[model samples]
Target: MSVVPAEVLPGGARAVTGTVRATVTAELGPRARLWPSLVAVYRAQLSRARVARIPLLFVATFQSVGILIMMRGVVDGGSEAESVVAGSAVLVVAFVALNLLAQYFGQLRASGGLDHYATLPVPPAAVVLGAAGAYASFTVPGTLVTAVFGCVLFGLPLTHLWVLAAVIPLAGAALSGLGAAFGLLAPRPELATVLGQLGMSAALLLGVLPPDRMPEAVRFARDLLPSTYGVEAFARTFGADPDWALVLGDLAVCAGVGVVSLAVATWAYRRAAVR
Candidate 1:
């Protein structure tokens, strides 16, 4: 039988609610309700997962902070540490890129969890939505940790605190989408790593290192990377102190790419799984 739209049963559970109730409810309860119960069940599941993963999350955060601190030391040295600054630039590009790939692919393979989602009554779209929310949630704590480390080590200022309000999330989401795109296409870990390196190279070529310094021929090739928007947003925010539109436009473009890529990936996964 074809998969049916899922509905919530009593006690906050979801079941495939179709005409063929016998087969569907034989495994999942029949007489399922709708949204509220489904949401409740999802929330309970998420709570349990967050609780289980809290310690691991903390350790990762601590490690990331240490990495940022070391990078920051090189960052604030100004021109005296030009090489360090370049390294920091490369590191940020790498950091942003890795955050996306690590979470997207690592969790799936490490936990061997894709099949779990395949077995659920929930729509495939739901997985992507949940993944997107979780990815967005990551941006919050990650940004906070990076910020604290930046201030403590490199002495990054909050002179224009509003700049951060607009900058960090957009950059994170842009990078996150690129990471997710890689996972959708990557068949093996080595291939994923290669893609990740390609992402870094593209970022450095177009964004982090500034295309302006490169010849027209060079920038032409790197223009393929979606990261230029993020870099431009940050650069304008700090260097030119231009209008808010600069960052907003950049963020919009980044978000547009992310949304489109996510949609395509989800569609591809669903068709492949159903086959």
Candidate 2:
């Protein structure tokens, strides 16, 4: 019997074995911490979103502005004006955080983009939160512009506009998570787009239109919508003697809903990624 050298056991055998070992080692490697992974993903998504930032900002601003203009005829001032302005501002948030995000993740999943993320040593929660945060960040400019413009158009007090500081993130977090969940859970990309559009339309109708104008049943539906609380919180601040307590309560509801929605989104991400 002839003894064969280990290196010559088979053609390319050692190289193949080494490659397999490397792959397994990589697969078994420790993942980056959640916060770092979140930051990295946020940066990457932010960069990607920047490419189309102009159109998105334009659409968000223009849509809100146009709504304000139309409402100008019907609503002269007072609580009606407050609702319109606040609703329009949050509408910008809904456009980016809810609408665009849904489309993005839907496309991502449909194109097998989740596979790329799955290969990375990153937590699934980070992926969901990072994407949501990136999208939410885009809402700021549009929301500010809308709020300022709506205030000018409706002649509402700008002193309380600072309330948006609390409103944006809370509303954005809630809506972004809902958008991400919608995208990941949808069976098809087209369905996700449709759902996103419908959601925005609901926000426009239920949020922008004064609750007083809505039927009792419709008002109840509006109450069920997460964005409504954010809108209410912002709207209340426009008053001369604003109720800080009520504003805080509304914001608290928004924060609570945000947590729930984001949790759902993380769950959806894990479910979708495995497929």
Candidate 3:
């Protein structure tokens, strides 16, 4: 029998191919760190959302403004007015962060977008947090406008309006994570949209209306909703002698819920990406 060259042997060819693949992989560099990946994803999502969601942002602002106008008739002033204003401002956050984000991820899932994200070297948490942060950031302008307009309409003090600096991100984190979970967990895009709408409605009814006006059962339900803490924290600031302790407590609770919800969303994202 004739001796074959090593290059022509099957095992040698396999080894050569493996070596080439390894070299190529090494040249590609290490996987990205979480912070850099997060920032890059955030920038991409922000730009895309800016162009595509501007109309929805308008709708959110207009919707909040309209609610304030309607409630102005029923609630002249006082704590009830504060509730309406605060809840409505936070509602803008809910509309985009909770409602729109659900729709976005739902569509992404339906369209094989998760596969694209999975192909990237970024951490799953980076993807979830980045998208959530981008959507949440959109709420800032609409939220501020609603708060300022509502304060004027309700004759509430503008002094503590600055508290929203804390309120928006905390509340947005909670709501955005919830929205992302809803979207990723839903079996269908339609179901995701429905869940988002229902969430927003809950915020509208339970958060905007004063807790005192609710029945015991409804009040309990409101307490379960994360956005209520944000509404309460913000509404308290309108008081002449605002309870800083209570406000901080509410904010702390909101922050805690945000962390929990975001962790859940990250879990949901990982689960969905695998499929």
Candidate 4:
């Protein structure tokens, strides 16, 4: 604290003495790097949501499995069966990555949870990606189970099931980012929930069904969805002679979409955090 003479007025008359106090701001350490911050947030989110996500994961798996069972009677082994199996597998990803993630972020935003994260030193992208990755992680077991069950139910060859290694991350990235954007951008949490449900419903209707049976307009709409590329990549593997090039092409599309969507989600995270 210090004492100072008051400034003279416009009339050249000095005022009274003044006291001043200086604030010594504490310097924070350097911000965490992207990878390390991402990992930290990922671990925190993963550990925190493990128990809560298990039951929802079970439901996702069971729902996909039930779809497989129903489709079993409708479609004997063929391309249709391949489509059904692939779609059912990716549907697990959609359920957790898209639907539940949207709900999570919506609730977080509504409850001022973003404020806590906003105060952290982590990048907004890391926060968004970390949460998305954790929620997506919960879908792995469900996806695998659904895929295996679908294969067995439809008599599809399991030789290329390993392609799931690529499909999961790519598709999860795309869906989770979209979910986060929806949650963060929505004016209300309930609206966010509706958007998530609508997105999942679109996945279920457009993805699980055989595209050939769909109207031309509907097929066009299917082409726009990111998860459908993953489904296509996975379904292509079920053929007696798999087209590796086409499979890779579909995966590439998914990868591209994932990158774009996640970037958009990061932007949304920033926008939401500032508010």
After TM-score superposition, the amount by which residue 209's alpha carbon in candidate 3 deviates from its true location, in angstroms, is 1.2
In order of appearance, the predictions have TM-scores of: 0.60, 0.90, 0.90, 0.92
Q: Which residue ranges in model 2 land beyond 4 Å of their true spot?
A: 1-27
Top candidate, metric TM-score: 4
| Model 4 local distance difference test score | 0.91
Q: Candidate 4 on 1-275: residue-level lDDT in tens?
A: 34544554354564543564565899888897899999999999899778687888889999999999998888987899999999999999999999998999899999999999888888998999999999888888999999999988887888999999999999999999999999998989999999999999999989999999898999999999999999999999988889999999999998898889899989988999987
Residue pairs in steric clash, candidate 1?
A: 8-33
lDDT of 2 by residue, 189-260 (tens): 999999898888988899999898778999989999999999999999999999999999999999999999
Candidate 3 has an lDDT of 0.94
Compare candidates 1 and 4 on TM-score and give the better one. 4
Q: Candidate 3: which stretches are off by over 4 Å?
A: 1-28
Q: What is the lDDT of residue 228 in candidate 1?
A: 63
The all-Cα superposition gives candidate 4 an RMSD in Å to the true structure of 5.5
